[model samples]
Target: MTAKRRRFVRDNGLTLAFGMAFLLALTGQAFAGHAEFNNELAADGLAPIGLAAYLASSEFAVDVTENWQSEYLQFFLFILGTVWLLQRGSPESKEIDEAGPESDKEQRVGQYARADSPHWARTRDWRQTVYSRSLGLLMGGLFLLSWFAQAVAGSAAYNEQRLRQLQRPMGWGEYVLGADFWSRSLQNWQSELLAVASMAIFSVYLRQRGSPESKPVGTPHGATGVES
Candidate 1:
């Protein structure tokens, strides 16, 4: 009922809505994935798996993990790259003069930190040191974790296929070095890079109306977030 409570609800409502939407979409994908996987099993003369079993299978794990790795890699690269790079008119990038990590004052750390700033910002110690690089660090770590998950799951999926054909199942090392693994990784990686590049370049000339991703419609093409 109070202003603070109303502000909190409004600020967090979008995040909650999107989180539920993402979960629903993922659940739908899992069901569709299970059905398709079972169809493949039938074609190969293998017993069809139930939804629970299919979800537990390496096929689902590998598919999910491969996509996750690509997403994390994209974020990791974007966060790190934007520090040194400038897109003249894009909302996603800082202006040319504001390049690099910028001063501690600009980042609102230590003496410049506000009363409600994060504890790490006030600590002035190792916590602040790590928190300063936390965004890129977390993204990089998640990328590695997702990549490893993909490798492990892919190996299991690959072995299952080999066994179905009465061929010898491969060891993890062999599977990691195989064409299938690299192909899956490269395909996703290329698409992610393409999307990021397109967003960076397109935002220079495009206007998305009220969307934060674009400058205001009336703004000059050379103008940046200042126009928004």
Candidate 2:
């Protein structure tokens, strides 16, 4: 590779790697889902859809958005919850005694902002307030949007199945409260919550040599919230 290209790849390896993996996974899902969907169509004596059609279908939309909503919900809760709650020995948490947002000086906002600080960090009004909570706000907003998309798409997909079975369709409100919606939502939610909980508890005892997510190998398990 060219020197410039090598440097660029090295600098962005993590994002590039995950981006490629995401594309590959999404492509695989499209193929596998299309096949599974065709099987259903076959059973019902309906024609199978084209790849483009399947990609635009409610089944695909709901499947994608359901997982997205759960992921964003996990991050939203973690971002907001960590502000007040903490686990003593987990690197995933703040110092045990340092719950809640700290002082403006500690955060380097307003008068405490350095020359290199973000413009909003130097502001003293509503802009600063908004910027201060922007992370949690963005995460929460994404969670809401994804969840809403999941509900809308899920309703359409569910209704299609109902029609296939010769049943009446449900309204949006009724469908959202029904077992199908809750089952999809709760299953994703349970997995996300378990992952978060596992990360917190596991970090308390585990050591990952060079990862920011874990304490240094030599660090005591009792050392609260210290990262490598």
lDDT of each: 0.91, 0.94
152 in model 2: Cα distance from truth in Å? 0.8
Residues forming the 10-long window of minimal summed lDDT in candidate 1: 219-228
TM-score of each: 0.92, 0.96
Q: Give the per-residue lDDT digits (tens) of candidate 2, residues 96-210.
A: 8899899999999999999999999899999999999999999999999999999999999999999999999999999998999999999999999999999999999999999
The runs of at least 3 residues in candidate 2 whose Cα sits more than 4 Å from the true structure, single-residue gaps closed, are none
Specify the highest-lDDT model's number: 2
Kindly give the number of clashing pairs for every candidate. 0, 0
lDDT tens per residue, model 1, 24-86: 988998999999998989999888989989889999999999999999999999999999898
